[model samples]
Target: MESGDLLLYKRAMFRLAHISDVHLGPLPAVTYRELASKRVVGYVNWQRHRRHFLHDGVIDAIVGDLKGACPDHLAVTGDLVNLALDGEIELARQWLETLGDPRDVSVVPGNHDAYVPGAFDKICRAWGPWMAGDGQADPVGRYTFPYMRVRGRVALIGISTARATAPFMANGFFGNGQARRLAALLDDAAGKGLCRVVMIHHPPVKGAVAQHKRLVGIGRFQQVVARHGAELVLHGHSHLPSLYWIGTAQKPVPVVGVAAAGQGMGGRNPPAQYNLFGIEGEAGQWRVHLERFGLVGAAVLPARIAELELAPHSAQVSLSPH
Candidate 1:
């Protein structure tokens, strides 16, 4: 390897990167034909209204950052592709394969991943090889999306919040079913003194869910979190990074989202970004340093960094909350 490559590898050893909402491909290629609803019209309108791209800019930008960060493990909250198009899923895999070891990268599904019929099944079957590691055991073992990992000082509790609700809904769901098992999974993780990271596609509370009751069921979900007292909660689907103070919980566990990749291909900038988490300090005093990275150009550059402080109940908290 070149001297520069060796230096990069050396630097990458200390960070854990968080990037979500890549939306990897364009409308036609990224989506199987839209369901018979307003969503179809929305997609058509988006293409006409936004920037067009041959390769989704966000994916390239994220891959570029991955090479630079060389993280221990990359955690993606969800929405890897715009739609569940076979090509889109394939596109996501191709990008992941190119960016970093598919092994080092972990993912949760967002609403978009389940937009089409049977999208999750096919993507999981095709991509399962890269998602597993030695001694990895499924928590629910029921679905590909809801799983767990004991990464570093934090124990990651990933859950499936993706669901196909109705035409009017662009929001997310965790289903009452997963809610039943979430507490158990979290209890076990916390009992071991692991700093819990609850990953989901939908915000347990925030955004459109605030205005529309039918948008999603964030209340019940937060109930599970309150009971378990998760250290951190990483989320996407809003296309904007956010931090909401969970009032009932013990402390403010950060709920973060990343801008969608390939932003302007549709006039939407997606804020095109990602973040890094640096875990350090002693046992009772563990800390998280949230660092921000933005995509500068189409060539996969992530520059412009910032940091946030994480309390014990903190996860990968991003600076400059939108």
Candidate 2:
């Protein structure tokens, strides 16, 4: 490449690392009082199957590999804890610290984070810094969804699909309120010529998860995306690596998912993994290259399992209603 082209490439490139559904564990002993509520089900589930799959060592290795890649920012799409136990929340906080400064890491809570009615509040308080919007103060008790954080040329918009659900349910909600706010944020980000990356815990794509674990307002969520358009969407809940397209054929948006970060080898789900997105180019013509790294088969260290260039944004157009 010529000198001018090389310079332009360097100027436009932004590397982002994505990981989710950590379900961080070795459950801190729970008391009979704590297990009195919905925690009982989750605790039981953890003991039976999740404990065998989700491993802290796997998370450590993934994080270590991700840091070595040195992406410009890290997007952790949630399920940071298995039971949303107080101790689990604190442990997640410490792990976040190991990842990077709050400014460098962005997080969104998952169904497990808000495992119970009051668990969401605890998550907001403890993981507030990583979840806070640009120029926003540390959330005291509550933080609104559809938060925006700009890093160089990208706008990381986080929306929470996390909510307390009845026992035996792992659903999420994306109400109309957040939809309106998200549309506005997308509009503003587009106006600024920033690449919009929407982050959510539950996959907005239809049939992405079982009926009980689906996103409640999936239609409204897609309506907003189809109307305003987004460069990319990242989500977690399925605990498997997946890719789906939303929006019109002319301006399709890539909805990407990753395997649970703490999932060990030989589990039902794929081994722990993360995605590295290399985004470059300007508003009308953008290019995104995805590099997936993880433990495959019986390998101990994470390796680059897949790499591909995503659909490029050849035109700056939106399907916004006239």
Best by TM-score: 2
TM-score of 1: 0.79
Model 2: CA > 4 A from native: 1-12, 138-143, 312-322
Q: After superposition, how far is residue 222 of candidate 2 from its true place, in Å?
A: 0.7
Instruction: Return the clash pairs for model 1, or none.
Output: 50-266, 50-267, 51-265, 51-266, 51-267, 58-261, 58-262
lDDT measured at residue 308 in model 2 versus the true structure, 0 to 100: 72
lDDT tens per residue, model 2, 1-322? 9999987775668999999999888999899999999999988888898999898999989999999988899999989998898999999999899899999999999999999889999989899999989987646343378899999999999999888899999999999889999999999999999999999999998888999999999989989999998999999999878888887777888888898999997777788999999998888677888888998777788999887778745322211101
CA error at residue 246 for candidate 1, angstroms: 2.0
Question: What is the Cα-based lDDT of residue 23 in candidate 2?
Answer: 89
